[model samples]
Target: MFCVSENLYLRDVKLSDSSIVAKWKNDPLIRELSIGLDTKITNENQESDIKKSIESKQPYYIISLKDSDRPIGYIRLNWMDNSERFGWLRFGLGEERGKGYSKEALSSFLQKVFSNDTHRIDAEVYAFNKISLNLLKSLGFIHEGTRRNAYYTKGSFFDVYTLGLLKGEFNYIKRDDK
Candidate 1:
């Protein structure tokens, strides 16, 4: 497991985790907003993906509640450029979508991202995804701008909003106290 909140842990997705991952992705409620893939989720797929995950030097974690230890969501921390100390994040929650955990989980991930001494953390979300937009804004990610029709899926390309948070912005969070 990986540490997200000060006392919370996030585990890596494993081949053994295929059942849960598939379940997480297959849930119509969760998949509608966060899914970026169209392929079927199988053990072979999970195994192959696990290899890629294991090979990456970046941070990736699965979200779980502090009380139940249930795998409710997943988060990925990766780079947009190799030369700069910068990255983007993608997140999904199976059953915890509206329970205020998105903000909590993101807060934790932001803390983790800044803790690594990085310069910036960015995100790109579909414009129609108001829940995600609000969640990110609530955590202080400034709306930088929009990438016009940057993502094509389902039928037409949708505009994606770009947002970012800086290391300095997280300085006021009472991390230890929380």
Candidate 2:
């Protein structure tokens, strides 16, 4: 699958993107925000995971710039329900965190997913992650509920907010190509 936004595109994740994912996974800051906070990942492990993703019929894409095919991050639809209409979203950006690429990429991905069989999309964000919380809210993701102290790390716990967006609630914004 391929989704084009102004300057970035969400394309099929390739085996070559494993190293970039491994680098991000190994970063302390990135790891702290992710579910696998305590788990250390190696390039080999990332490669194996990529292979599994390639083999599975899941929606996974690498966020890449139009000017360059190299991936700066990735987004995936995960934890799909038995009904196949709902799924959770997980994404990570390496050195391109502050850029608007993620916002565009997510918009494109959501549009693509909702245009098909998917009805609802869920995102679990740590309470301390203000950026993600703001992003989700701005994207029209309703704050459904919170799992208090759901994430434990370094002798402390953090709440996790479960944000959800239904297909009807999504507002697809087009970039003014002027």
Candidate 3:
């Protein structure tokens, strides 16, 4: 599957993209904001994951510029609860940070997700990560609540903000309906 939004696009991740993904997964800034802050990732680990996830046809994608074959980030639709028509959302970008790439990629990805079996999508963000919080909020994700002291990192605990967005709540399509 693929999603194109303006100059950005999301495509199924290839095994060749594992190295860059592993690098981002191990970045200090990325790790501190992520749930698995304590765990470390290596290329070998990423390679193994790539192989298994490919076989399982996991819903993960590489984010790239529309005309480029190189990926600058990744996103995944995970833990699909068919009974609930919900999926857990996860995304990350590398050196491509500070750009609007993520915003565009996410907007497109969510549109694609909701067009199918997904009714709602959920995201967990570290309270300290203002960038992610703002991005989700700007995209219409509601603040469900916070898991107090849910994340432990840098020798301290931090709250985790839980955010959710229903398919009906997303305005990606209507924004251009006019």
Candidate 4:
């Protein structure tokens, strides 16, 4: 899958991206914010996971700058049911955390997915990750509920907030020149 916005674009993940992806996965700050296991991942393991994800035809994408084509992050949709319409979103950025890249990338990605018959998207963010929570809300995602003490990390448990966005609630407008 490929998606283009004004400043960024997203393309399918490739095997060559494993090394950088491993770096992001092992980053301390990234691990703290993510809901996945905190165990460190080796490049080989990341490569294997990428291969399997590709073979399974999952919507895993690498977010990059259009001008430099430099990969800064990744976003993926994991389907929740057999209908393939409802998906759970997971994303992370490397060194480009505060550059507004995520918003553009996610906007483009969401537009593409919604246009492709996706009915809804859900995201679970750690309560401590206020940036992601605000970002999702800015994109029209509504706060569904909170899972109390659902994620244990950094020697403490944190609440997890569930957010959902239906296709009808998305207010993005696609520009032709992008």
Candidate 3 steric clashes: 0
Order the numbered candidates by TM-score, best leading: 4, 2, 3, 1
Evaluated at residue 174, the lDDT of candidate 1 is 53
Cα distance off (Å), candidate 2, residue 164: 0.8
lDDT of 1: 0.72
Instruction: Give model 4's TM-score versus the native structure.
Output: 0.92
- Which run of 10 residues does model 2 get worst, by summed lDDT? 169-178
Residue-level lDDT of model 4, residues 1-178, one tens digit each, is 4978888889999999999999998888888788356688899999999999898777899999889999999998888877789999999999998878787888899999999879999999999889999889888899999999988876888899999999999867455322
- For model 2, how does the per-residue alpha-carbon lDDT over 75-125 read when each residue is reduced to its tens digit? 988747766699989988888878777777888888888888899999999
Clashes of each: 1, 0, 0, 0
Give the alpha-carbon lDDT of every model: 0.72, 0.83, 0.83, 0.88
RMSD (CA, Å), each prediction: 3.1, 2.1, 2.7, 2.5
Per-residue lDDT of 77 in model 1: 76
Residue range with the least summed lDDT across 10 consecutive positions in model 1 = 169-178
TM-score of 1: 0.81
TM-score leader: 4
